[model samples]
Structures are given as C-alpha cells and as structure tokens.
Target: MALKELEVRYATKRSRDYKLADGEGLHLLVRPNGSKLWRMKYRFEGREKLLSFGAYPQLGLAEARLKRAAARLELAAGRDPGARPDRKPAMTFEKAARAWHEHRAASLDPGHAARTLARLERDAFPALGKTDIRAVTSADVLAMVRSVEARGALDVSRRLKQHVSQIYRFAIPHGWADTDPAAYLSDLLKPKPRVRHMARVGMEELPKLVQAIDAYDGEETPRRRAVTRAALLFTLFSWARTNETRLATWDEFEGLETAEPLWRVPAARMKMEREHLVPLSTQAAALLVSLREISKTGFVFPGDKPNQPISQNTMIYGCYRMGYRGRQTVHGFRGLASTWANEAESYRPDWIEMALAHAERDEVRGAYNSALYLTPRRRMLQDWGNLVEHMVTSDAGVRRDDVEEVGPPLTAVA
Candidate 1:
C-alpha cells in the first residue's frame, strides 16, 4: 500500500534513525531529529540501486510517484535516472530568502533578525516562497503589497517591500537574479500620512486594564502565570518597550542594593548603537530584588525554554488574553507613560525624552551620566511609579480623592 500523507506527517522521531516503507520500494527516511526525506529503490543494469527524491512535504507523495515512474522509464530505455549532468538546482524564493536572511541577519541584532524572518514566513512565504527568484515580476510584488494594504496595515506593506528588496539585492550578487522587481514598485505606493502609534489606554481606562492583569492566572503552567504577572507589572512600572524588557539580562542592572538603582542597556542590544540609562523606581527596584531570589542565570526574565530569553510574543499576548488584543501592545505602557509625563509638565521636554532614551534637541549629546540630569530623572520616575501603583489597585479609578492626594513635586525637575 502507498503511504498516506497523514502517516508520513505524523511520524515521530526515535532514539535511533529509521525508515518507513510505502510498498513499492519507496520509503520515508526518518532522522532522529524528526526530518523526513523521501527515497526510492530500484534495479538498473543487473545492479540494485537507490535514489533520494529530496525531503517530504517539499516533494510530496504524488510528485515522488511521478519521479519514480520517470526513473523507471529512463531505466527501460537504458539511461541513468540516478545521474543528470545537465541539471541545475532550482532558484526558489525559499532558497534565496533563506540565504538572504542568513546573510542579512549577521549584520543585524538578534531581535531585528528574528522579526524580519518572521514577517517573511507569515506574509511572503505562502505566496512567493516556491516561485523562481528570476521569474518574480513587479506585478507579483504589487499583489503582495496590495494584499497587506487591504488588511489596513500600510506599515506592514512597506516592511514587506523593504524585505523583498533586500532579498533581491542579495540574490543579484550571488548569481540568482538580475534586477529587483520590488524596487520598481516603490513609486506606486502612496506615502503613509504619519507613523502609526502603538495602541495605549488613557488614564481614564487604565484601571480596567490593571484589574484584568491582576486577575490573570494564565491558562497553562504555573511559570506562565508567574511570568505574565511579573512582566506586566514590570512593564507598568518601568514603561520600557517590549523587546527591551523581554530580553533583559541580570548583568544590565546596577546599584540594586542602593536607593538609586538603574538599568544600563548596552549599545549592541539597543535599536541604535547608543547606550540608554533607565532610572529604576522604588517599585521597579523591588520587582528586580524579588526576581533575584529565583533566577538561575544572567537572564532577569528567563524563557520557558532552557537557555533562552523570555519571548517577545509571550509578553504581548498577556493583554490579548485580557481581551485588549487590538487596543493595547506591550509597548503601549511606554505610550501611556509618555502621554502622562508630557501632560503633567512637571519635567522639561529633554528630561522626559532622555528618560525614554529618545534623541535630544541637539541630536548629539553627552552620555546619560554626564549631560542628562540623573537626580531629577530619578525623582520623576519615582513619582510616576507611585502613581502607577495607585492606578493598578484603585477601585474608583483615580477619581477626585485620588487626584487630590498626589500633586506634582514642588521642586523643579531641572
């Protein structure tokens, strides 16, 4: 009997490598690491022979059968199916994208590399992955951009275009193709009116978000529940971007035993090659101290998998479970903090921007320890953390009584 697609797919790896038969000398070779490659056996010129037909799913059952029939035909004609001198490997988009991603990822940071490939897998692969690199036309690229734009994500459309261009740029040097089809379509795309902002809840709506987070126990494991709570609360207190928080290491912290603790983000890990100094608030410092009792490695927030950082998606999906899927991102906490600080006007614009690790008005400034006012920034962060704690636990949602108790500090944050 022929092998069913389901059986071929559901086959699991064993301690030792093994194979599965499909009755006509066709077999699925299963490696211990779970890779399944298709192979066929036959006899030619009074000698028993075997031929590998490539990996399963990539070369399916029907295609394998066709190749087998063709091989038999060639053998009957006294020609060799096992060897083809004229054959050249197909230039598939998957092939080129893998090559490009590998080469491009080397020059980029770990976080950016992971995200770029993820987009390729999700958006680009299904449509163009198998297409020949040289055969892809501008029309094909247009359809892809239009498909994403139809979903109302103009930013995603732009990113897809940029990644495609990079892939083609890589292919040309490697002798895969001539010109980039995606490059020609740049003129056709309408410029986005403004950069889309990360979704964030206003002060009036914050208590509901906090209540949902506090009530969350997570669906699967105890670690999941604990990680969710710690990550969410840390984000609320520190107001850092998702990736920055998720990939945080224990070595990045300093002065945790003192009243003025800080998180020193290294340049290589940052978006730009500039060091960012984050003043740890009283609550923020406490969270780190609690995390210290259990962490076995340098990772402040360890991942579910051994020797891995906490996943960026896991942090974002915490709110997805809280029924704020489209209304809040992990970075939304930063947006909320930015809004509150600017509105309060207790601190100067430079102080708030510096605290956020954003560029200064001069665009080229001294390091955080020298130029930016650390003393004032520390006080600003503490004030913000205190307000956030009140918001998280308050029942009346920062009503008149809550507002009256906390006033901006009398001393100027100069």
Candidate 2:
C-alpha cells in the first residue's frame, strides 16, 4: 500500500532503521537517529539498484513520487536510473568557458581562437575555474577582474571580463548558468589609455619618400633590393596593409598582361576577413611583371626561410634604412592614401574607403555594399596610382596638371 502524507509526517523512528513503503519501488527510510531519506528500488538487467532522492520533508512526498515517475521513464528508455540520472554533472566556469570557446572557435580564425583561449587560461581560470558557473556572483567576477587590473593590464582585464560574459551568455541558453556575472563589469573596469595612431608621412613629403624608395640600395644583392622596392611600392600603390602585401602569392594576381590587371586578396589574409579587389594600375602591373622574372618562392616577397613570407619587421627595417625611423611606418601608407583621397574633390569618400578595404559600420549596408563600388573604386585607385607614378618619375614633384590628367580614360584601359 502507498504511504499517506499524514502517516509519513506522524511516523515514529524505531530502535533500528525502518521503512514505510510508498508504491512502485519508492519508500521512506526512517532511521533511529530521526533522519528520513527517500529511496527507490528498481530492476535493471535482472539486477536490483537503489536510488536516493534526499532527506524527507526536503524532497517532500509529491516530489519523491515525481522522481519515481522520472526514474521509471528512464528504466522504460533502457537506462539505469541509479547510474545515469537525468541531471548532468555540475557545470564549472572553466568547463562552460571551454565549451563556449569550442562553439565560438568554429567561426573564428585559428590564431584568434588560440589567443582567446590563452587569455581565458591566463586571466580567468585560476580564480573561477572550479566554481559552479551558476554560483559565480558579480563580486566574484569583479575580484578576478580586479586582480588582472592590479597588475596594470587594464586592457587585458577588459577583454577577460568580455570573455567571461560571453561564456555566461553561451551557458545560459544551455541551462548551465542563470545569471551573467561579468555583464556589468565594463563600467567597473578602469578607463582605457589614449589611442596612439601609427606614424605616417604627410602628403607633401610623399614625393621625397617615393624618390628614396626608387633609389633604395640597402640590400646586399641588387635582386634583394628589387624585391624590397617592389614589395613596398605594391603596398603603397594598392593601399593594402603591409602584412597583406608581405603575404601575397603569385596566384593572387590575375590578368597581369591584360587591360584589367587585378590582385585578388583572399579573405584569410585580410584583416577584416573579407576578400579585397585591387585593380592594378599600369605602373603596379609593371612592378609585378618585374617580380615574376625574379620570383624565388611562392611568396611575392620571400623571407629568409624557405616557404615563408617576409617578416613583420622587414618593411619596418626598410623604412628605417630610408632614414624615416620613428617618422613613418609601412602601415602609414594607407593613412596617406586616405588623407589624399578624402581631400581630393574628384574622389567619393565611399570609393576611397572601399579602396582602403575599411569595414562598413552598418551590417546590412556592409552586406549590400560588398564589392558594389568596384568600378568607382578601380577608377579612384587608378587615379591615385597615376599621382604616385608622377611623383616617382618626376624630379619637380606632383603638379596640379599631373593630378588632373590620371592618364587615359577607363575605356582606354578596360
């Protein structure tokens, strides 16, 4: 017979342990010490097993019955209720974080994913790893963030908080956590330091820089010098980042001998993770033609090691050799290009931004604008290339007429 609630409450403890049977393998085990525990007896594969549902009154009669019903459901599904309960293992902060990282890593670049994991391991794991993710309070998160901030890594602290918040955000949907402890941490962190822009030369000084690059002879071999000059010039003319140009392969270039010469940068190498189209001008095409004749490796600018691209410091060292140390950077060429184009009345700002491969701020607009301004951007870059060529070939520097000429019309080239 099933035990009644009043009987369960009024049941007396005996000298030895005793049980009041509830129906269907569920019973209340009342001990001599005045402790009552809910237990269940079930058969799985001809073997009897016992499952505890906690102390009586705490689990209550109705809840214990529900547990029995759930256990029977588990048995009906061919699973052992005693061995494998419906509840999963407690989710710790580190475990949740790692799970989140694994889920996030699928869409991220390998290097970026590695760095994110490294940051979590370095800043978050030591303090919060073993703590239950649901139990982690805002104060607990703040303490960990403060520890990082104490070491003067304000930026790291900020990123750590963001990572923690993201972990919680990832956990909540899966029922691992109920609250995000790191959500309010952004306001608590120290203000970031002032922004420092990369060093770059002014437009007025561009002619002298171009002249210096043309006459550059710092490399031991003439062939090495040619490689350096071509690499730098290509970066400048294409308005591409130094790393993009450094990692360029011959296969990325197309239609070199034709009118519509192009450099198709793959999305993997790009900073924004989007493929960029660079319409190679007449001068830029000529540089690639020269590079092809002296190509040593797959990389357009082969580094010291075989099958490797040029080092990050290679172009920086080239700028240093040109006596522009601390005055200009290889990356600064894009800034100069942006400044020149924005100041020019002929070029559209959107076309100039597209040429620079800057990400559009609006997601919907960015999706719609992908490679949409190609024709106008091509003309803008071609005009910029003409101005660069004029500066390089002329001793008198860039004149108004030269900037206005931009060689022949788009029809003549295309």
> Pick by TM-score: which candidate is best?
2
Q: Give lDDT tens digits, candidate 1, residues 277-300.
A: 888887777766766654566787
- lDDT (tens digit, per residue) of candidate 2 on 1-414: 988899999888898667899989999988776878888887789855567787878889999999999999999999987663565448889999999999979887676677789988987899889776765667778989999889998867877887887888799789776446686677788887886777988889998888777656567765566667678878888998988999999999998888789899887777665677888877777677756665678998877787887788888889999999999998898899899888897888778878888878675687576464767777888888888766755443322332122222111222
TM-score of every model? 0.49, 0.61
Candidate 1 regions off by >4 Å? Answer: 1-193, 361-370, 394-414
Pairs clashing within candidate 1: none
Winner by lDDT: 2
Give, for candidate 1, the lowest lDDT window spanning 10 residues: 405-414
Note the residue pairs that clash in candidate 2. none
